[model samples]
Structures are given as C-alpha cells and as structure tokens.
Target: MRFSILASGSRANCVLVNSGGTYLLVDCGLSQNQIVDHLAELEVKAHDIAGVLISHEHSDHWGCVESFAKIYGLKVYLTFGSAKARDIQIDNVSIIEITPQNKIKIDDIEIFPITVPHDAKQPVQFILSDTKVSLGFLTDTGRITPFILEMYDSLDGLLLEFNYDDQMLQHGKYPNKLKKRISDGYGHLSNRESIEFLRRVNVRELKVLVVGHISDNNNTLSKVTELLCEIGGEFQKIIVQKGKKTGWLCL
Candidate 1:
C-alpha cells in the first residue's frame, strides 16, 4: 500500500491511499483545483480515484467533497449525519453512507469507519486494510476512547493528530472558552496526549507514523520534535522524527 498526506494543517486536511490499483482519498478538504494539482504531483489522474471518505463535516475535512465528486465522477463515502449537517447535495454523483456499524469495501481495501468524539455531527476516523497491511487515518478528534485504542492496536501506517502543545494553548491568545474547548476532551488532541496514546497502542507493526494537524499558533515543530524524542522509547519500533508535509510512505 502507498500512503501520502496530501495536505494536513488547520486550513485543510486530505490523504491519499493507493492499494491494489485502487486510489482512495480520505478527505476532500482542499479545493478542487488544489486537489487536482496535488494528484498530478503524485502522478495520479483524477479519473483514477475510486472514492473519497470523509472524516467529518468540518470545512477542514469535507469542504470540497461535493465539487470533487461531481468533477471526477467519483463516489463519496460519509455518514448520514454528515450529509445532513453539511447539507451536501450534488446532482449525479454517488454519495454512499457508511457508519461505524456498517463497513464498506472498495476493491482490495476494506474501510472501517470508527466514530470519534469530535464537535462535528457523526464524526469518524478510518482504519483501512488490504489484507496484508493496514493504515489508520485519524485526526480532528478530541480524546481517545477505548474503542479507538482497540481498533488501532496494530497498524502498519498511522496519520495521527498532534494538534497543539498544552502550555502554548493555555498561554496563547485564544479566549478562555476557546482554550478550554481545545484542551477539553471534546476538542483536538495535544502533542502530549498523542504521545500517551502511542504508548498505549501496539506499534509492533507500525512502519511510518505521521504526527499531523499541528496548530500553526499553539504548536511548534521544535516542540513537537522534542516531545516525540522524549517518548521515543515507548514506540521502540517506530522511528519517531519531525516530518514535513507532502511525502509518500510505502508499507
């Protein structure tokens, strides 16, 4: 399987996963033109994309899904609540509804949408497998649950959230309520929280770990790098390091 974090940040989030000749986009947050350009950079054609799986209804995750689907004639897989919350409507494109209770398959990939605690309606993260390898795509979540830990126990590749640094968040310019919301269990995960999660889950099979969705204001690359280094012993198998966006990992 080939995994690429096409774009990941506060502004937008999108991931590309290719397995057994099928190309799937985990989100369509980027504009249609931006997505098209990125696909070109990856040497993948728009028509080759089999489907798009949305994590939530947030603009940073599901913004351009309708336009992308309509333009490329690709299917979109998202929850019913997300469709309703976003009021998503596209004329001829197919929008497949998937929930935590009901999984779906596309070619060799079997997608499992696990519900997560986020502010959006019916928000979910994905665990995708192609029999031999599994890739966990998780972001835009507040806290980790037991179900989440169990589901991502053994993943070959992971795109996990490291949204912020608690110290910076507490002292940052954001209002008290906004600060509480982000640090609260219903908002995004801090770098410390993410490290704790990595400690709990099994990383025996982990090949590449991407710390994503970093806050431009509340977090810094140097801080994230330092934290990961401190917890490097936890995931002895994972080569923890600071990474830039737009790179491919083969598993």
Candidate 2:
C-alpha cells in the first residue's frame, strides 16, 4: 500500500491512498481543478478513483466533495450525521452512509471508520488495510481517545494531526474566543498532545509517520521538527506542508 498527502493544513486537506492499484481518496477539500492538477502530478487519473471518504462536513475537509464525486462518478462514503449536516442529496453521485461499525470493502482495500471527537457532527477518521499492510488517517480531532489508541495501535503507516504549538497558540494575536475554540477539548490537537499520543502508540511496526494539519499562523515547521526530533526512530517521518503534494510513501 502507498499513500500521498495531496494537501494539508487549515486552508484545505486531502489524502490519496492506493492499494494494489485501487485508488481511494480520504477527503476532497481542494477545488476540482486543483485536485486534477495534483493527481496529474502523481500520474493518477481522477476518474480511476474508486471512492471518497469524508471525515466531516467542515468546509476545509468537505469543500469539493460533491462536485468532485459527481465529476468522477465516484462513490462517497460518509456518516449519517455528516450527510444530514451537509444535506447531501445529489442524484448523480452515490452516497454511502457508513457508521463506525461498518467495515467497508472496495476492491482490494478494507476501510474502517472510527468516530472522533471534533466540533463537527459525527466526525470520523479512517483505517485502511489490504491483506498485508494497514494505514491510518487521523486529523481534525480534539484529543486522543482510548478507542483511537486501541484501534490505531498496529498501523504500518499513520497520517496524524500536529495542528498547533501550545506556546505559540497561547501567545499569538488571535482573539481569546477563537483561541479557546482551538485549544478546547473538541478543537484540535497540539504538538505536545500529538507527541504524547505517539509515545503511547506501538511504533515498533510503524514504517511511515506523516504528520500534518499544521497551523500556518500559530505553528512553525521548526517547532514541529524540534519536537519530533525527541521521538527519533527508524521509521520514516514526513511533515506535510499546507497546499503541497508530497511524494508517495509506501508501507
């Protein structure tokens, strides 16, 4: 299995995962044109994507979901709450309402949706596995939960959120209310929180660690890098930048 971070950060977020040549998109936050350009860069055809998994109804995550799905004739898998929140009822696109209990199979990959705590209604992250390897996609979550630790313990690759730096967020110029919203239990995970979660996870079998959803205003790459240095290991580490496409990493 292989995956790429097409875009990440507050502005937008998207991920492309491929298992045995079967392509799937975790989210479609970018515009249709941007998505096409990025896929072309990776030599992937947009129409070849099998499905799209929406984490939530937030604009940064679900901005172009409907248009992209309709253009490519792809199936959209999302939670009932997310669907209702967006009022998605497109006739041309197939909307597959999935719960945390559903283990959906699409060609060579099996998808497991796990509920997460976020500001959005019924938000979820995904764990995708083929016969041999598994990849976990987690972001837009407030705090790491016991269920997340249990379910994501054995992933070969993980695309996790490293959204903010506590110090920077505390001292930044943003309004207090917005700051509270971000730092609150249902907002986003800070660098320290991400590090703590990493320490608790089983990293012995982890190969690729892709950390993303960085805050452009409240966080710096150097800060994230310095913190990550403390958790040095043999696993390959990647820091995804905002509005950038990373090269494919295989598991």
Candidate 3:
C-alpha cells in the first residue's frame, strides 16, 4: 500500500491513499485543478481515485469535494450530519453515511471511523486496515478516543496531528477568542496532547508517523518534532506535511 499527503493543515487538507486496486482520499480541500497538479506531481491520475472520505464539513476538509466528485465520478463517504451541513449537491456521487465507533469496509480496506472531540457537526478520524497492514489517519480533533488506542496497537503508519504549541498559541498575535477556541476541547490538538496520545497507545510497529496539520503561525516543525520524538520513542520515522505538497509513506 502507498499513501501520499497532497497537503494538510488549515489552508487545504487532502491525502491520497492507494492500496491494491483501491484508491481513496481522506479529504478534498483543494480545488480540482490544485488536486490534479499535486496528483500529477506524484505521478497519479485524477480518474484513478475511487472514493473520497470526509472527516467533517469544515472548509479545510470539505471545500472542493463536490467539484472533484463531479469531475471524476468519485463517491464521497461521510457522516449524515456533515453531508447535510455542507449541502453539497452533485450527481453520480453517493454518500455513504458512517458514524464514529462503527467499522465500514469498502473494497479492500476496512475503515473504522473513530469519534473525536472537534468543533464540526460530526467529525471523525479514520483508521484504515487491509489484510496485512493498518494505517491510521487522524487529525482535526482535540482528544483521542478509546477506539484509537486499539487501532494504534496495529497501525503500521499514522498520519496524526500536532496542531500547535501551547506557548505559541497563548502568546501569538491571534485574538483572544481565537486562541481560547484553539485551546478548547473541540479545537485542534496540541503537540503535548499528541505526545500524550502516542505514549498512551504505545504503538511499536508504527513505521511512518507524519506530524500533520500544524499551525503555520503557532507552531514550528522543529519544535513539534522535538517534542514528539521525546515521547514517540526512537523507532518510528516522522514526517511533516505542509502546503500543496506530498509526503510519501509505504506500508
């Protein structure tokens, strides 16, 4: 299986995951043209994508889904609440309603949508599994759930978030309300919180760990990486994804 993060974070979030004969995307935040460019950069085609799985209705996650689906005939799988909130209307795109805490199998992959504390109407993080390997894609949440711990034990790769540094958020130039919102339970996860989760899960086979969705203003790559390594042990490789770029990982 191969996976590449086309981009991640508040600007535009998307990930292309390919396993066996199935090609799936976690989000479609980028426009059709931008997405095409990134896929082309990785030598992948737009029509090769079979499905798009959305985490929520937030603009950074669901912005270009309708246009992309209309262009490529890809089915979008998301929660019922999120679909309603987005009000996305496009033909040839089926909506597969999935709730957190339930496992849904699509073709060759087993998807477990784990519930998370996020500000979206019904945000979910995904843990994807094939027969041999498991890849957990989780972000845009302030807290992890018990279901996550179970998946951590089996994951060969993880696309997790280290959204911010607490001190930066507290002292940065952003407004007070925005800072408070970021630190809330429903907001993005901090570097400290992410490390705590890594320690709690204690994943050993975690080969690829991408520290994703970092705040460009509030956190630096070096700071988040240093803290994560301090708690993520010394085995797993960590990569940070930024802008309209690609980070490759094999599982």
Best by lDDT: 2
TM-score of 3: 0.92
Candidate 3 segments exceeding 4 Å error: 89-93, 232-236
Regions of model 2 farther than 4 Å from truth: 90-93
lDDT of 3 by residue, 1-251 (tens): 77988888888889888888888899889888988988888778888887899999998898788878877877898987788787754333476788777898878888888887888888888888888888888789876667666666647888888899999999999999999888888899898888888888857777778778989899997897678657745455555556646556788
Residue-pair clashes per prediction, in order, are: 0, 0, 0
**For model 3, which pairs clash?**
none
lDDT of 1 by residue, 1-251 (tens): 98877788777888899998999999887889888888888899999998899888888888688877878788999888888898865433498888774678998799999988888878889999997999997788899999899999989888888899999999999999999888788889998889899889988888778778889889988887887787654332222222234656788
User: Which candidate leads the pack in TM-score?
Assistant: 2
In model 2, the clashing pairs are: none
What C-alpha lDDT do the candidate models reach, one value each? 0.83, 0.90, 0.82
Model 1 off-target regions past 4 Å?
A: 89-93, 233-244
Which consecutive 10 residues in model 1 have the weakest lDDT in total?
A: 234-243
- Model 2 C-alpha lDDT per residue in residues 49-105, reported as the tens digit of each score: 999989999998997988888778889999989998998764434998888857999
lDDT of 1: 0.83
